[model samples]
Target: MLMSAAHAQVSLQDRRPVLKGIETVDDPRRIPRKPAAKKSKITVLRGGRVFDAVSAAARSATVVIEDNHIRAILPASSTDWPTEARVIDVTGETVMPGLIDMHVHLTYPDSDANIDEQGSAVDGAMRGTRNLRWLIESGFTSVRDLNGVGEAPYVLAQWSADNAIPAPRVFTAGHIITGTGGHATERPLTPTHGHDYAIEVNGADAWRGAVRQVFKDGASVIKIASHFAPDEVEAAVDEAHRLGLKVTCDCEGIYTEMAVKAGIDMIEHPLPRTDATITLMAKNHTASVPTLQVYQNVIDRNGGFYGSTSRRFAMTSQDDFDVFKKMKAAGIAMGVGTDTIGDANKMIPNVYIAELKWFVKGGYSLADTLKAATIVNARLLDMDDKIGSLEAGKLADILVVRGNPDQSLDDLQKVDLVIKDGIFYVENGQLVTPRHVAQPLLKPSPPETTK
Candidate 1:
């Protein structure tokens, strides 16, 4: 059997073996003696102010994208582009790296009515697919799903990577690993919802096993819950690191201290932490994704505090802001995440914008806030080297907004264009059909007979 070059390339890019029972021909004679040289498809954005995500400023420049990687970022005056390059004039626009969201739950319902409903896998898949499209259309080219329901996230991740669906690049931590009756396991386990949101395991060895299980299920990162012994957290962290992955924890107060001590790479929330723990986190370079917007939503929807009986009642929005300020003053690495579980259409831009505004309110400059959403969030995902900034040799995941977002984050909502992996998904502030979807799917070549 023979496979097309395109199919073989996709397999290699995925770092997975080809499907079973389809053996590729190994005969040298059957291969082309001299394959035709492929021409590079070049697209240039001319006369745009480029914000590369490194400097805290945008400069007038031209970006030359060749295939799926940036070829160069030339000066606005430079006309040194290939004659075949398709140039698009982007004067008065801002071209920057695509944004990233470090924390999201794609499988969760997008509305209040369905929030507590026990949906099946098919329902979860539908919701997740819808969320993925909303994320990409909103200028998020990459996202990390911290706790997805069942296999929905893993399957979605694969689909997004293969361009089988229109979605941002997805990195997921299959299910939350927690002790019995821990943070994520609070809901009653029904037949449909049992162990889909979280897996309750006990003991240090059990934590290690949970880490291994999620990794086997194609999770690139590990998410663990709090209220566990120090040794258990340590075991989970060690197992994840050994597998060449990072572990983040969703815990507060003493649990935060324990997770940090266990060498957790990131903390999920801006929960109350002692000054000593903050110092330790800064010293150890532990990253944080303070999902302040989610907590604020809880308070707002429930009228003031999340009710007097709720554990979160004591923590006010002001308290969340104060904790963020402290973390910033301590030089803790922070990223952007909304943790939105409402109507994506109504909540995405609003929730995401609110998160950025909170960062500004917490003493981050507008430029720095944008960085947190792009390169900084990429660093949190350990993917900065590939897709964080707009630079030569990086993936061509770029965004062009109508106004200067570095000066005012509100202008970020004007997403004029978005390009992921060199394919245009959005243009003129509208979503377009992806190239893969518009074209016929690649098929394997028929086997050739030996002469």
Candidate 2:
């Protein structure tokens, strides 16, 4: 039961395998980069239970992560493993890919229950740095941050890329584009709100300019509130795509329909989609991210406009469960995104467990539910080449739990080990980097006096 220490897929092409090619993808385990004979930083996670993220099945395997990358996965028992490298023996544990939450607010601060986006760029950067540490420690190795103040997300993205900071892999949406008074826009009554945060553009021409601004700022993904017109959605999609970026729209009513029609890449918050709408989405290759639990949080709060808690919760009650089943049956690309960003679910990893229940109620058999979170969502982020599955040569983003997650979804809450990019983040349920920052992480500042 010795898995080969060599596994590297030649990407930069379709699934065309080229085992013997000159231009190969970087393989840390490949034949010595040169004659220097570089040493490997290997970590053999000895005995553990692993969720076959690719196949969505649990398998007893010995996975070795070397030099911050996965080297191999062997189908063998963990009896007597090597002692040289960093090793973790989770004899009675389960493992899967670190979770991906497509919707999160790393820079959005809150007081009471309302999120505030009026922070300075530096403030956002500091908050994002702190949030990234919490995210990775909590088992989220990757995240699609919606929007943040200024270029704060981009700075954080660069930090994690260098591993100068250990945090979740970030796919940033930069800033949001919105119509005159869309959700992202500030209300006149709310003085604390930052009206300048969203790129508020009304006409198609204005949207084009905004898209150019976001592109200039290096946005990995484009996000716009489609509460405007179909023409507006179409214009945003055309411009954003022209710049080689995917567009995600946040909406519920006609906005969703417009977004799907205008060839939007994805939609957040799965509302009750119609049969015609579902068909259009399937045909147009559009995806829906049902941030159901987030919607539930809004319902729990029962704020103004949606006033009644029980009624608002019942708003998408029928639409919630069936939308996923119908989409799955219709062969539409339905990805997973946890929109719940406050209270207990504020910690990203906890949302993955609740998200399963949303799909479960939608007639998704347990296996498919897990797949949607791991592989399905990974593919949407255009990061399938590196992450998503427990295959060799991929970045070793793994999670080992106490019980089979499929049989009992709650088993994930009791994770024994979490490995991301060959780094063992959690060992036996205790994080290598603890989440809580009880004491101040900020350095000392000198006092200032005015004459």
Candidate 3:
């Protein structure tokens, strides 16, 4: 016999459910060795024009990094240099904060794979690990995985943080939360694959519990889908905000309006939204990710429609593009995300670059597009104070590219170097495994010397 939603709710509230496979331990021999003790080192980058993400243009400057944080950004003419610092000369290059992708699905299969043949959790893990490499190589130092199969994304995030894998900083929403048979829940249900991508629930109370479940499972952000009752979404937003996590919704039309009104922090796509919905989003300061490239890909692949014949959603590429333009014009805060789930190999650099190009095509300057990808996206992630810009006392996630990206958007393709957490992940246009260094343990000063 199957359990009813009401009965399931009682069980969930009685005892927290642990995510499947979270407690499994890997073989000791397969575990990567712990990081070596951290040693402070001073490194200076000289002769490169820097785009601090706060400035209108890249200017000649010298950046000094101490350990894993930026110690200073000195003027080009200043000569007060640290004597022991190792300096790397980057004459004629552009140095800036590493790029961020506000949305991604790291567990999805390659573009050529059939959608119906979704893989197992182990397959998702392997696919995600491969995708992480492509992301970092393309200069994305951090990404937020909006959804993934089972516990795959969460496990991958932990692995990336532990330096057990060569990957970017990862923030993940373990599984999307949606109403029963809702958007992300449309996948074919089988015994093993059921609820792999999203959890289905009914009623406002169940909605709140769903939020708690994902939060307890180590989700850094909450992702919910629409076609839900107004009260249900409202309960979810309230619960997530109470837990100190921001909520992002994947919705269109009336659903979008409801989410914005319910205080959703972010909306996922540039799907059709009314003028009133746009106004409300701007007024409420709700940000949008406007994943234009993915929708455009759909149109291109389907001969001008945004969806297949059976699920057309009655929208077109131009329709979505127009909504994106209007949202930008309304002064709504927006970020960049490539909702490139399939064909990532062929789609990544192109999709990500195309998204920025669309921004420029819609009246944004080259510098504006760069900021959208850096600080603006960082702010959306609530990580602006730490990783967004080339500022002192910020994490050393810097990127050096061959040309002036602020002047020519295409120049961003020339990724010469990438530094995350002061570790060199890519140098001279080549990927290298960095030696992990763990922070030294602080010991209590020997019992205050009885002076």
Candidate 4:
């Protein structure tokens, strides 16, 4: 009378699977305009050990990318290849989700070189083109730019989307909103503090205006300067949500407490938060991105060195180290971020490992720290469905590190390869870009050739 689940079938089946008794048309002319041109040819990556961040053990697996997304994760034994398919042999490496850092000042460089004088129409794009490879070489495949210094983050992000740059997928908040004389408004040099154009809103009304302004200018998230007042912070979050953007804050103590109450989406800091503050943050689903690396790099100016840039940027009593463990114990969400600027003199490939090392030193288990940087950040980005793990149908945002991150967080410093958006940016810890200088090339080059 009725077909059982196994017996049910479709008529005139093609290569594609059936959906609800309808089969995808095999006729080229009949296929839809949107998907026909971009149909993927399978690319199989074989002989790789997997360190799927969510999984407990490293499995030998075959990863297949179809178009821009991962199509399948096959077992070690499955070698069935489609004709004309490309195969990548990763004989000895570990594959895991690409790293995610929530707080990055994309506009900053280690030195004071004028990148402005050096480039074409795409200043940020060019800088990103150079730096993206550096990030990938250090095993990062995604970053959340906390601030856009020179209108560069957007170009880099768009170029990455245009498949022009071999960098990690970037989600950026165009600029940070700060009160007229807020911490974000303060600058290191000059007798008179300059207004941070990044965010120069005055009050609740101005905060409300920035929500729409940031989105129109191409921000996926809205950030508000909150150390000034809790009610002021709440107003911005409320306004940003109506326009459809997640709200993040850069503040400490009561600023964070009020933001949690206001329903801020995430907090960016080393979390100068207390145990009570951590509990409230957890209850409110507020995530924290401890840009500890940046803050830790805070050199003491009063100690006869350069001014502590981190201390200058920080607000309130909570910006200390103890807050991290208390927050971790209280079960607050954490994401990876390195506010540190890097280049040749720094001797660091990327700031991510620096952030991870602190988590290990600060008493988080290695696995938890990895989860914070990878899975947790993905979840915060609303990209968990696409990149957090080696899941099918997700984009192949992955990295292979030198040692097992599961064994120790310190091993994270040794990078192996970085693959983002199904493109290889690095292999064997070397940037795939042609020989170029990381120092002088932080400006736009000819888009046609550099790409």
1-451 in candidate 1: lDDT tens per residue?
1222232111001111232233211110011234325569999999889999998899999999988789999988999888989999999999999989888888876564443473556677888888888878889888888886778988998888776777888888989898887776564433223467788898889998999999888888899877788778877887787776788888888899988877788998777889999999998788899999888887687644532111242577888888888889999999999876555434777788889999998888888999999999877776776788999977899999999999988888899988988888889988887444355559855669775
- Alpha carbon lDDT of each predicted model: 0.79, 0.68, 0.79, 0.65
Error of 4 at 338 (Å): 0.7
Give me candidate 2's TM-score against the actual structure.
0.80
Query: Candidate 2: where is the Cα deviation over 4 Å?
Result: 1-39, 77-84, 111-118, 186-193, 303-314, 340-347, 433-451
Model 2 C-alpha lDDT per residue in residues 365-433, reported as the tens digit of each score:
788888887788887776676788777877788877777777888876776766776766667677575
TM-score, cand. 3: 0.85
Q: Which stretches of candidate 1 lie over 4 Å from their true place?
A: 1-39, 112-118, 188-194, 303-313, 434-451
> Please, what is the TM-score per model?
0.85, 0.80, 0.85, 0.78
Runs in model 3 with CA error above 4 Å? Answer: 1-38, 112-118, 187-194, 304-312, 434-451
Better of 2 and 3 by TM-score: 3
| Residue-level lDDT tens digits of model 3 in 1-451 | 2223343111011011232222211110112344456676988999999999998988999999988889999999875666988889999999999998888988876654544565567888898998888878878888889888878998998887765776777878778888877776554433222477788899989999999998877787789976688778888887777775788998878889988877789999887789999998999899999998887877777766534211237667788889898999999888999975667445667789999999998889999899999999988877676787999987898989999999888888999988887877888878897556878669855687787
Ranked by TM-score, the better of candidates 1 and 4 is: 1
Model 3 scores worst on lDDT over the 10 consecutive residues at 8-17
